[model samples]
Target: MFIIELTYKVPATEIDAAMAGHVAFLEKYYHSGHFLASGRKEPRDGGLIFARATSKGEIEKIISQDPFSINGLASYRIIEFKATKKIKAFDDFAGDEI
Candidate 1:
């Protein structure tokens, strides 16, 4: 699992302008099962995403497709982790170990 944090690099207006494309990018990943959950951060400075992937490189490739990334509107911080415990609802997405 990975925690993908997006921090705005440009102004909010710039991020807003790319919202539609950004959403489309998110939808694509979500539909493909790479993304589990995502939403804006409090104070609206950036966003957060929970995703599943085999490697950080895979996540980086996915991130490269984001409009925010394409337009250089945001910076990404990808944190990889091993899930020791999770709800039953997340079983499928949580990988085999936990």
Candidate 2:
């Protein structure tokens, strides 16, 4: 399994557009079992998404196609890491083994 930390640089104008498509994209991934959870940062800064993917490249591709990216509402920084450990709530889904 992989953990991706995405930092979005929110731009004012595209907020609504980004949000409109965000839900749709999230639903698509969630039903497909890729997205685990997601939310915006405090102060409504950026957002984060925890996903399970086959490869780092796949994650990048997924993010690149997100509404934020497509509409240029936000820029993103992606950090890909191996899941070495996890706390109770997510323990069942954590690991490099998956």
Candidate 3:
């Protein structure tokens, strides 16, 4: 399993449109069993998403469809890593416990 952290630099003009699609994406991923948790950062700096996927490619596909990427509302950085272990709260999430 892998964890993907996405940070966006949103432009002022596209904020509402971007957020609408962003929330829609979150709901889609959650129902599809890919998204674990997602939300905007405090002070609205950007957003954070925790997802479980088999490969970086899979995660990339997900991000590529985001409103931030689609409408050019923001940009993102993806960090890929193998999860060695999980403690307490994270471990309690049933889908990707590795």
Question: What global local distance difference test value does model 2 have?
Answer: 0.70
Predicted model with the maximum lDDT: 1
List ranges where model 3 is wrong by over 4 Å. 1-3, 87-98
Model 3 deviation from the true structure expressed as Cα RMSD, one decimal place: 3.0
- TM-scores for all candidates? 0.93, 0.75, 0.74
Give a tens-digit lDDT track for model 2, residues 2-57: 45444556554557656878788878888877788887777676777888776877
lDDT, candidate 3, at 93:
57
lDDT tens digits, residue span 46-93, model 3: 777777776778888988988777876666666666556767765555
Q: lDDT of each model, Cα atoms only?
A: 0.91, 0.70, 0.70
| Error in Å for residue 44 of model 2 | 1.0
- Distance from true location, Cα of 48 in model 2, Å: 0.4
Off by over 4 Å in 1: 96-98
Better of 1 and 3 by TM-score: 1
